[model samples]
Every structure is written in C-alpha cells, then in structure tokens.
Target: MDHIKRPSLSGLTGKRHSSRDRSKDDAAKGKQKRADSPLIHGQQANGAPSPASRPAKAASTMSIVIESPPNIFFGTPTQSTGALFSGQLRIAVVEPEVTLQTFTMQLLATITARKPVAKDCPECAKKTTELFKWTFITDPKTLRAGDHSFPFSYLLPGHLPASTQGMLGNLEYHLDARATTRPTPSKGAEEITFRHPLPLSRALMPAPEKNSLRVFPPTNLTAHVTMSPTIYPIGESTVLMKLAGVTEKHEDHQQRWRLRKMSWRLEETEKMVSPACPRHAGKVGGEGRGIAHEDVRPLGQMELKEGWKSDFDDGNIEMEFRIRPSGHVRPLCDVDSPTGLSVTHSLVIELVVAEEWAWTKRPGVATPSGAARVLRAQFQVVVTERAGLGISWDEEQPPMYEDVPASPPLYPQSTAPERSTSTSHPHTAGSATPAVARAAAAMNGSGDMTPVVSAMGATQRPPMERRGVTTEYDGPPLYSPSVVPQAVPALNMGGLNDALPRDEDLEDIDLGESMRRPGPPSHRNSAS
Candidate 1:
C-alpha cells in the first residue's frame, strides 16, 4: 500500500510541473506576438529589459514664448523710420533636464513683392526681399528645467512698404523665430519654434489720378492739374493748376467773366476730439468730454500774376505752386475713432473777382485792398519722406503701371486700375474695358481730336507768370510717341482753327467738330 501511494504522489507532482510548463509556453507565445511593438523592443516575457535595446535619452521637453505690449500701433510711430517693432522672446525648458549644446534666436520679417508672372501663367506666384531681420545666440545656460528671456526692438526703414493683408502684389510684414537643440542623456534631440506678425499700418494715399476736375454747384471753376505722379516722392512736388471761367453770361462786364487774382496755399489742419472712452478726461477734472486742441497751419502761398494784369482775357488763369520749405504735408491717414482727432492737409485755391457769379464762396476771405471775390478749390495730397530709405526692385521688371508697356493701347494712363482709361482685354493684364480701347484708338488716329483746353500746356499757353519761386512744372498730354503735335495737324491749319482757341492737354475730350460755335466754351470737371 505504501509503495502504491508514493508512486501516485510522484505522478501527481509530475503532472503539476507539466501544467506549469504549458503556462510558461503560453506566456512566451504572447511575447512573440508583440515582438514588433515599440514598447516591447527589448522586453522579455517576464518584462525584463534587454541590454542591446537600452539606448540613450530616457525623456525630454522644450518650449518657447514671446512677450509684447498689450496693443500694437498700426499708425506711424515716433521713430527715425516711423516704424516701431518691439517685443521680448523667452526660451524655456519645461521637462526632463536639457543639456543645451547650441542655442539661437532669430527675428525675421518677410515682404511679398509679387509682380505678374508671364502674361499667360496666372498660376505662378513669387516673392522677393527680406524686409527686416535680426539673429543672436545665448550662452549655453544648462537650463536645469528653468527659463531664459531676451528683449528686441527695431525701427524698419521708412521706405519699407506698409503691412498689407492678403494683397498679393502689395506690401506685407510678418515675424519668425526658430531654435536648435542637441540631444542629451535625459533629453532627446529636439527644436523649439514660433512665428507671428507685428501689427502695423501706413497711410499711402495716392494723389488724384484724374488729369482734371470740374468744380461745380459750390463754385464756377473748371480746373486741371498735372502731377508727375500723384505719389510725390519726398514731398518734392510741383503742382501746375489751370482754372477756366465756366460761369454763365451776366449783365455786368466785371461780373460776367474775369479772373483777377488766383492764389494757392498749403493748409495743414490738426483736430482732436473727445475720445469715445474718456476715462482719463474725467480724472483730469473735465466733464466726461475730452480736452481738445485744433490748429490750421498755412505752409506757403503762390499767386498767378496773369489774372492781376492781363489786358485781353477770355477768363483762363494758370498757376504753378511748389511745396515750400516751411510747408508740411502730412501722410494721408484715415484713423479709426469715434472722437479721436487727426492732422490733415490740402491745397486750397482762392480765385478772386467772381463772387457774384460763384455759387459757393468763403465767408471771411476779404482783403483790405479791395472787394475780394474769392472762389475756392480744394484738393488733398499725400506726402512722405524718403530719408535714409533705399528702394528695392525686382530684376525682371519695374515696380509700376507706368513702367510697363501699354496694352490695348493703355500707355498714358498712369493712375490706379479704376482710373486707367485703358481697355480691359481678356488676354493681357494691363488692358481695360472695350469702350475705353475703342475710344482711345479712335482718338489716337484721328485729327478731329481737338483739345478741350482744361489747363493748356506750355506749347499752347505762354510761360506761367513767375513772381515768387521759379518752378519747372509743365502741364501734361505727356504722350510717348509725341501724339499732341501729330494728333492735331489742324493746329497748324489757318483761319477759324487758329483763332478757334488752340490749347494742348485735352485728356481725350470731344467738344465737337465746330469749336467756333462755342457759347460758354462748354467744360467738364472730372473728379476721380
């Protein structure tokens, strides 16, 4: 009985040991199934780490932060270039110890100056020039999971374009930051990066592109002005103005038609209103309404001498005005505010001896010398300085509408697209509307293109009477192939055509074939 029992127990023990071996085999199979997993790269069935798979860098972390003012000035700030870009950058180690081998911080701003790609390839896009940039490296501080910060400030050059949003071929500005890191025992290989844009706005009001404007309702004056470019450079501007008498016939000889004195003055006006939020005004012991300051500064004034002395006149006065050294032309700006004030500028012309005929008049423009009949004409102009600012240009092409060749014959229209009197052709980018092309073509080839005579050029009128400063400003109809002389061969023709009031600079106007039947010399004042 004892021998039988011993054998049975031994057999039982053997069976138990075999069951344990089966369980071990199952565990081993599970391990085999997960052999390709990242977590099991060097682990065995019992979760023991493999020596070969035990590499460096157990864990790591990194981050970057930038601090700046609560608000950004979208207007020209007080600086050399009038651009104020300021902020602070912070580098930090947020996790597992990092042994920084090399650390760097870069500040960069990009501007897109995309001109039209090949006329046929509209899909193509491109950019050029680095608007602003700065770079520096911090000494490896062995950031033991702490932080580091750096401050930066820059005044972009004045000539730098304004910050534009989504305007493909226009000015735009943005900021970028990048960092490089080395791998460490506790920190693996990594990099920290951040990018944003510095908010800014520039006032670039292009001068009126329309060659001439007719002042009506308020005043009886037909005026034409020619600017080399409405966008005058560095405040160096020469304004040539011509005024015609478009008033109706009156009973009195003096009241009917005569221009005595014509004067243009540069006016700078600054106004400040109660801010919508007058939080500070109330604290200053004022009625919640804010304190205000307003001032109008007259830069300089020029008068056309012809009106004062001309013997035989059919009521036409020409004047050339210059930006005086003392004159200040403010940058054109449209600030957003319910009550905040701003400084503005304009060219104001005061025509004398026409009060009885004029529909509009200035209340207190009387001179002690005589009965002043002042009719006024006002125009806004954009002014800026280019000191220490260098211009950037693309190698392939110039940076303007006038620089490019004419399309559908759109050569002389050197203004904005809306103002350009060119035809819009589907194939070419510069062409304009169908009606414009037809009109331009007809005017270009025909002799019937008589001068409408807004403000006649040098070839038509005598040299402008110079009293103060000598200005070289000439009137326009500035054609490329010399269209003025060639287009109107009738100017050389005799009889009524000669005495039919000859004048250059019509700007494509059809008065009629028989200018001889003129009553008031029908005039048009284009305001665009």
Candidate 2:
C-alpha cells in the first residue's frame, strides 16, 4: 500500500472546491473595496452622485408678494401719471437666529439684443439699467427663525419703455433682491437671492381716425389713406385707400393707369444700442457708448390681384381691406426707450399700375401701352394694446367721503303748458263742456285722439252720474234745440267713420267751419 500514494477523489474534489471558493471570495472582497472607496469628483463610475453626497442647506429663503395692482400706464408718456409698484420681500430664516449683513432690492430694466456687436461678450448682448433701489438693511440686523417681510414701493415713470419681447431684441423688467448673512461661529456667510420678472404695458386712449395723403411727382397720381389712430395686435384693422388722378385725357387719346397688382406688408423695425461692459468698453468706442443696430422684418403681408373698384373715366381707384398682425409672430407693441431701444411699425403698400390708351369717345375700350410703373407708399401706424375697460388707477378709485357731494344733483323742472280756462262762445246757445272742448282741440292737434271719444261720450251724461263722481256743470247740453242742427252726413262705418277723419286728413278739413255748425248726437253717442 505504501508503494503508490494517490490522492483520494473526495479530497481532490474538496480541495478544488475550496480553491474556487477562495477565488470567488477574493473577487467579492475587491468589489466591496471599490464600492467603499471615495468617489472621484464627487461622482461614482456611473456619473451619479454618491449616497454620502448631499446638497448644501440654505440659511434663508426669499419670496415676493405683490401688493399693488397691475403695472399699466393709462395714457401717453407725457400725460400719464405713471404706475405704482408695491410689494413685500419675505425672507424665511432656517437657523435659530441669523444676522443679516446686507439686504437690498433693485428694479432693473434689461435690454437684450439678438444680434450683438460682440457675439461672445455678455455685456454687449444685454444691458441692465437700475430704475429704483431699496436698501432694507444697511447695518447688521438679527432676525429670528421665522418669516420676515420688508415692504417696498416705487413709482415707475410713464416715459419708461414697457416690457416687450421682440423678434430682434427684448426689453424686460425685473425685481432683484439679495440678502447676505453675517459670518457665524459655525457657518460661513451665505447669500440668498430672489428674482421676479415684472411685465409692464401702456394703454393709449382711442383717438379719431387719421387721414393721410401722398402725391407722386410728375405723374398726377395721388393716394389718400384713412386708418384708425391706433392699431391692435389681435383685432382686424381697416385700411381705406383711394387713388385719384389715374386718367389723363389728351384731346382724342386718353392715358389711364390700370390697377394690376397690389401688395401690403406690415413691417416691424427694431432699433437698439448694444452697450459694452467695462471689460469691452473699448470695443464700442468707449464706456456708455454702444453699437447701433436696426432690424426690419415683416409681421404680416398680403397680395391681391383684384379686389378694388377702378373707374378710368372717373379717374379714381378705391380699395378697402383689413389687416391684422400675425399671431404666430407675436408682434411687439410700439415702444420708445431712452436707452436707445425702439420698436415701430409701418404699413407699406406697393401697387403695380400699367398704362393703357383709350379714345375719349370710347372709354370702355382700351389697349395696354406696355408702360408700367410701381407706386410705393408708406404710412406710420401706432400699434398698442387694447385699453379695454381698465381705466387709470386714479380714475378707477371711488370718490372719497370728503370729495363726494353733499346731496344728489337737482334736475330742471319740466315746462309744461298750463291748462286753459273754458270761455263761453257768443254764437252757440248750448256749448260743450270744458272736457269736450279740450278733447276737440286735442283732436285738431297732433296729440293722440283715442281719449277724445271717451271724453266726449262722458259729456253726454251729467257729471254726477258719470264714473260715480260729482261735479258742477252749469253749461247746457252739447247739442240743444237752441243750436241749429246741420244735416247728418252718411256714416261709412266699414273700418272708420268719415266724419272722424285720421290725423293726416284732419289737416285738409276746416276745423273752424265744423265747430261753427253743430251736428246732432248720433244714437251710438247717446247710448254711450
């Protein structure tokens, strides 16, 4: 048995298994070390933050609460009283107590250009102007762990340009606030900043429509345009155009300009001065200097081959069309800023007029003369937002108790004619009562005569017997024996009696003659 010592299959298998297990353990240990190692650049191999990495906590937070109404200038810059802006800057402290070293808020007007002089320079692309500033804390102040409010107010000048976002540039207003905490025993100084964008607008009251005229030299061609004083972005604007002096007669042959094609374009021009920062001041000549840039683009356009009434004999061409700003373009309103930022709109109309010859005797027949001319005209248009029902702040406020009147206004009394007294006629033996005479007089006038029949019928009975009312009547019967009775006219009662003519027919009748000859009462009148 000692001659050959061979390892047992079980022992060999166990050794192999132990070796494989040890290798696997070693690999597991290596992976655990790699996982436990410090991350590179604060990230794991997958580029995700490590579990131990955490965001730094802020010592304070800031928020803004606007207290005043919307910022809207009610009239033109020169006439407006400006708009009021009021708000509160709230800071919530997280620590037990924090000492604020400096706290300030600023109202900044920033102008940004899409096309800058220096493309890589931030200052050339954007310029910010400080309109107003508020210093909440000039000295170190302690605040408890709670919310603190700092009220701020400013009157934005009316002349200041409103916030606008244009295709070539942008004008914006911002409320920027910064709060710095004093260095503490356990923490370094921390900064808390808050920024809120504020939008401003101006409303120009509607004025009368404007009429403009342009005359082309040496051609006897003139254009008359009538348009609204103000244009809106969302609504349609009518443009009325009349072209006169289009025909010229030369004895037998007449030359006339015929309208062939017309094109209208609404152009938005944006002008801005791209200022440079101190670092790049030399690039734009010097500090406070900038490169002037102007950009023109069309907001809307249209072409018409035929939509106008042309009269060669009358020597005139009339056209009416509606134009609206493109909503997709988001056209900017008119703005003029002292910071060298301006936006304007102009309506350009181009007409292709071709000359034609026709005999004065035969104006309807004409032939093209192969001579064509292009007539171009431009008109300045004011584009603004709708004023709507929103009036100025001062005008919208209710009247104060001291300013209110003590009592309501007094109205003038109506001057109605006084009732005339009844007078006895000398010719008639039995006269009608005052009511009957009044009714007859009313029928003669333009007054309604429906009450006349009722009034006269009431006179047939005694005043005490009528309507259960009593009154004194010394006059005789309206138709009595003393008065000579005239012949009874044939009554045509199909629709209305001829005796009682309408108001229109009453004008031809002789009222005095009818009143002189009294007629006997009819059976209908007596029954009433």
Candidate 3:
C-alpha cells in the first residue's frame, strides 16, 4: 500500500508543469476578453469607430452689380406728335457692373383719375383704398431698353389716358432696376431670389430740362428740327426741322363750337425757275425751268387721345408733330435768303390713329377704349415751303422732265486716218519735211529771210563766196529766228535763178543803208 501511494515522482512533476502552463494560458485569455468586451466603452468589438459629427453652416452673402447707358440727352426731345412722343433715354444696370447677362428695360406711365369708393367694402376701408386708388392710365411697361445704353431711347405712343383715349399729359417717368432670381424659369418651378428694384433715376429718368425745348401739349403740335448746316457731308452744318401740329381748342362761344379734331400732311415741291430775278438768276428764262414736285408723305401721327371732357369755353387744344430728315433736304443761304416755292401741304387725313378729335359730351373718366379715346391725330406736316429769292414768295412748280440731246460719238483718229493726216500736216513750207528737215529748211531760208538785216548787230557776217555757187550751213541750223523777216540777202548769184530770192525778200532788206553807200563787192558775181 505504501509503495502505490508513492506513485512516480517524474509523473507528478509533469502534472504540475502542465497545470502551470494551463493557468498562464487562462490568464492571457481573460486579459484579451476584457479588452475586447463592449461593456467597457459601449462600443462594438470589431465595428468601425463612429465619425466625429460636424457643426451646421450659416447663410452666405452674394454681391451683384449692374451697368447701364448714360443719361446725357434725355428730356430734351426736339419734337413731339400728339400721342406720339419722340425722346431718348438711357438705361443701364447699377450695383452689379457690366455682365454678359442682358437686362430687359421698359417704360411705364401710371395714370390715376377719379375713383369711387367701393360699395361692398366698409366705408373706412373703401375710403382708404379709394384715396390711394391706382390705375395705369398709360402703362408703358412693354417698352424695353435697346442694347446696354443708359436711359435708352423710349419711343412711346403719344396717346395716353387710354380710358378717354387722350394724349399723354405733361408726363414724367420714374426709372428703376429689378433683379430676378430666375431669368429663365420653368413653369411651376421655384426660383431663387436676388435683387429687388433699386432706383436708377440718373440713368433712367430724363435729364434736366434747363435747355430742354418746351413741348406744350395740344397747342404747339408740330416741331421742325433743322440740324446745323448739312447732314450730307458729315460734320457739315445742317438744319433739321421737325414740323408737327396739334389741334386744341376751347370755344369763346356759349355753344362752344370749337374745333374737335385735327390732322396734317407733308408735301414737298421744287422750283426749277432760277431766283435770279433782276439779275443773272432772276431772268424770265429761268422761271419754271427746273420746277417739280419731289416727294410728299406724312412724317408720323399723333392723336388727341383725350382732353377736358366738355367743349371747354376756355383753354386751348394743341396737336404736336415733328420731322427728322435723315440727310440734307435743301441748301441754306449763307446770307439768309429765301428760296421760292409755296407748299400746298393740304392732304386731310381722317385721323386714323385717333378715333375722335374732340368730344363735346362728358366722356367716361376711366381708360378710354381704342375707338373712343383717340379723338384726334397729329401728323408731321412738312410745308417744304421755299422762300423766294429776295423777299418774294414763289409758288411751288411741278417737276418738268425734259429730254436731253445725246452727244455725238467721238471717232478715233486712227479710224479716219486721212482727216487726221490732213489736220496734222498743212500745205506749209515745212509741212512736207521731217521734223529734222523742217528745221533745216527753216535755217536754210534764214539767210534770204534774214530779219531786220541790221538788227543782226555784230552777230552778222558777210555772205560766203564759192565757185559759181554759194553753200550755206546745211547742218541742222542753230536756233531759228522768231522775229518777222525784215531784209533779204543782196549777193548776186546769176545762175542760181531757181533759188533766187523773191521780191518779198528784197523788201525786207535795209535798202536805205544799201542805197546810201554802195559797198565794194568782195566776190565777183556768180555766172550760171
């Protein structure tokens, strides 16, 4: 029994070592388990760590700028037609500078007349709304700015007060700019917002009226614009006159049978007759020479859209008209003289644009309909009246078309050689000779034709002698004498009859000296 209990010492040692190794392994496993446990930090053992949360963002501010045209020449319109107003304005963007984005500009005229309180609303509210009631008598919002120019030209219908179809009143416009979030928007889609409207008075509104030409409504209807000098040669002085008419009237009569409507026409005529009366251009022959009717047409139309309701016993109705000729129409005198030509500018236009010229009955104060509002029309009536030369008034003459004679054809010299040759060569002594020979012939005759025999002075020499012959210088003679012949050679050569000097040559000789003193002949007379 004692020996069994003792067992083997080596086995006991192995068991102890195995138990120690097991214990160390368990301890290491326990440490790893504790480190991997989710309960410690409340995080998954193998999951990714949560990302750090970020703070929210705030709103941003964007800057915008707009550019527009300059307003230099606004409100100084030189012409106006009843309801037709001709003026230019500058339009541009402010805040934001020039950009590729184009802006749409428009002109608006809001008119408010009499407004009655609504019966439905409470009296207090109705009175308030009625007090500040606003109706667009002439809403010209459709007019857009042309290009990028500021205060761009705003061509608006002269007719205003649509309710009564009346002409625009002494009107003024307020200019402003607006920014839209969605310039190009889809239907039913929400658009981002940007600029509201900022007043651009300087760029949009009419400039100061300091030197502005006055355009009174109704009475002063037509405006004639004459550019300084001539518009043909640019920079040249032109006079551009725009003529217009307005028919406004208030009867002094109790019945007030005043003129209701008015319209005008333009007729241009030219005077062919020269104004040279009593002088060069004034002769009777110059009359009606170049007279003719050039052209005639209406410049434009303006209408009396509306006016004071009843046939007023006072005040005047004025129609306005204007003309802007593109180029030079006629020459102006340097000395302020009149050109002759009367204008029969009498083509009555039954105011087309203006339905009614004048209304005697009280018209409904609201905006007038198309037919009722327009009571009168104004047209540019260019009289084209010519001031006659001097102070006289010349009647305009009809155009005369005269046939002009055709010029004779010029034949080439080569086509008529005989005629050309005859003209070039006459039957003169030098005609048959070549230029060189002609010159030689002139020199050869110079001896017999010696001029002013004594005027030759010291340059003269005795005639040369030869054996029964006299040989003169044959080489191209020196400069020929331009003077008329005075004397001929006196040397006697008998057989040289064929070349004998004529009686004309003898007359030219200084016979007085020769006869006074008979000089001794150096050479004997030549024998045939």
Best by lDDT: 2
On TM-score, the leading prediction is 2
Q: Rank the candidates by TM-score, best first.
A: 2, 1, 3
Mind giving the per-residue lDDT tens digits that candidate 1 earns over 1-528? Answer: 665644357557767788789999998897777765556567765578877677743233333333433222222443223444466666666664555555444444343223322222322222334555556555654555656666777655544334432212323345666665676674456665666655544443233544657564444556777653333324456667666663344343333335667777766565543221233334336544433445576656777746233222365656666654343543333222222335456777777753333322431222232334567778775444332332211322355877777668546855432212222222112333334335545654542323422222325433454887565546544432222322222222234333433234355567765783534434432321
How far in Å is the alpha carbon of 490 misplaced in model 2?
59
lDDT of 2 by residue, 94-199 (tens): 9898999999998998988887777888877887889889999879999999999999888888787889887667899998899888887776888899999999
Count clashing residue pairs per candidate.
Answer: 8, 0, 97
Question: Residue 288 lDDT in model 2?
Answer: 85
Per-candidate local distance difference test: 0.47, 0.81, 0.30
